[model samples]
Target: MRIGLLSFAHVHAEHYQALLRSMPGVELVGFWDDSVHAQSYAERYALKQYLTPQLLLAQALDAVIVCSETSRHREVVELSARAGVHVLCEKPIACTLEDAEAMRDVCAQHGVTFMTAFPMRFDPSCGELRQAVHSGQLGSILGVNGVNHSENPSVHRSWFANPALSGGGAVMDHVVHLTDLLRWCFACEVAEVYAALQWTDGAGENGTALDTAGIVLLTLTNGVQASIDCSWSRPATYPRWGHLKLDVIGTDSLMVIDAFADHLTVYPPDLTRPVQWLGFGVDPNQAMLTAFLDAVQRRQPPPVSWQDGYEATRVVLAAYTSAQQGRPVRLRPARCESTEDPGDGQGS
Candidate 1:
């Protein structure tokens, strides 16, 4: 499959380039980016760079990866769909629900595949947790808790702080991963959200509207209560700012995934490692890109569909709305069943 890159503004673009190059059945036709810096970066990677979307689309590629700024996602998707090209868009899909829905509709109308880049779902450890939960190793799930914290970006990449550009700070940028994970793990939708937001000294100094600290309480459709603690300011020396810890309480046992420790610890009155470490030792970007290529070649749906992307965006958007209104925000009921295994199947 011939693939074209829509933009290179996102920090994750390098991951995509490396993965696309390594995939067996795919070719990196070329790339397009509006910013001169982005174009220069693409060139440094030896990618054929173009100045406009029209030129990129003219290559007649089979798929396009939209890794542009969040605000430009809808436009990129629309262009790709209109050109009869499949799309793999970066999250949080678009800046608003309307734009996300619009992209979905257009893709459907054009008969083009639409997938969201939610690589966490493909984690090997995540796969094991899903199986453990599904096989009744853990009984009915009770609650979930996640933490994603990182050092604030320097002023040089201040777009993350701008609401107009990045959507709405840390919640917009970080919460979707956990939200989507929870949906897949429990096979349920978020029913409501209550949240509190704060901006730290760094956020103020950066002159961006993004928050540095926040917490969100969620009520899932299956009666699982989940909470997310997300922050953007951490000591620079911290090993990982994006540390994630998940505790899934079931009637029979508890499953914990310590992403920072790179291990999945299971507790059944006696904590013991499972027969398999769910955390596969593979690069997530490579696994996800390979999956995308497989889907395209087989003419099958992507593991993380456009609908999945849209639902996750809705959940995150609801959290932002809840924080802004100082009241609980109710989510629309989910239209489809959630996947049990959020695995990007690469053995470590």
Candidate 2:
């Protein structure tokens, strides 16, 4: 299948490019990015660089991965949908709930498959934790604590710290991962959000006023309380880019997941780079990409649907609202169902 990458602004875009090139039956049909960086990438990969999004979409591509900046997702996805191309969009679907809904609605109207790029759902450890909870091995879940901590991406990509481009600071970039995982584990939607945002640093890249750190408290429809430590607290000298982990408290037993724990830590003598983490385990991004390709080939819905992405973004956005107002924000209540799963395969 031929798949073109929409933009190269996202850090994961380069990783996806390498993986796609190595995968069988998948052709990396070049890319289109307005930034001058695209020229270097195109030259390095020896792939055609489309001068415009429309030109790339006109290549009869089966699918496109929208890796544009957080705020530009809608425009790129809409372009692809108009061309009848399936989409695997990067996380946080859009900056606002309205844009997210529109993206979901437009894709549905066009009858094209759309998926959110949430690679953590494909992590084996995370899958086991979800299974344990579903099978009653952990009894009834009472609470969950998840952390998605990372170094400031702005240090490497100027857009990450730009409020206009990234939507928010660390909270916007990290909250979706844990929020989606919690929804997947419990098969329920959040009912309320209470968050506190803070920034030890005066200002981030581009003088963005977005918080550098935050804590979001969520109440699930099923009465489970969850909290996420979404922060850009790591320094450049940190060993790895970041890590994801979660602790689940249940009536019977507790479950903890170190999603990126399958790695060997090395302390390099060189002062230039202090440490490194070499991983030999499964690459969740590769797994997610494979699932997307399989779904496209079989004409089935992708594992992580647009609704899942929208709902996750809603929870995070609500947290921001709660923080700004100094009160909990309540979401529209939904009738609780007894279904064992959320039905989206990747959850809603």
Residue pairs with colliding backbones in model 1 are 122-344, 124-278, 125-278, 125-279, 149-241, 281-348
RMSD of each: 7.1, 2.8
lDDT of each: 0.77, 0.86
Q: For model 1, how does the per-residue alpha-carbon lDDT over 264-335 read when each residue is reduced to its tens digit?
A: 543445535223233336666777787877777777777887777888888778887888899999987866
Off by over 4 Å in 2: 200-202, 267-271, 334-348
Q: How big is the positional error of residue 189 in model 1, measured in Å on the Cα after superposition? A: 0.6
Which candidate comes out best when scored by lDDT?
Answer: 2
lDDT, candidate 1, residue 341? 27
Question: Model 1: which ten-residue window has the lowest total lDDT?
Answer: 339-348
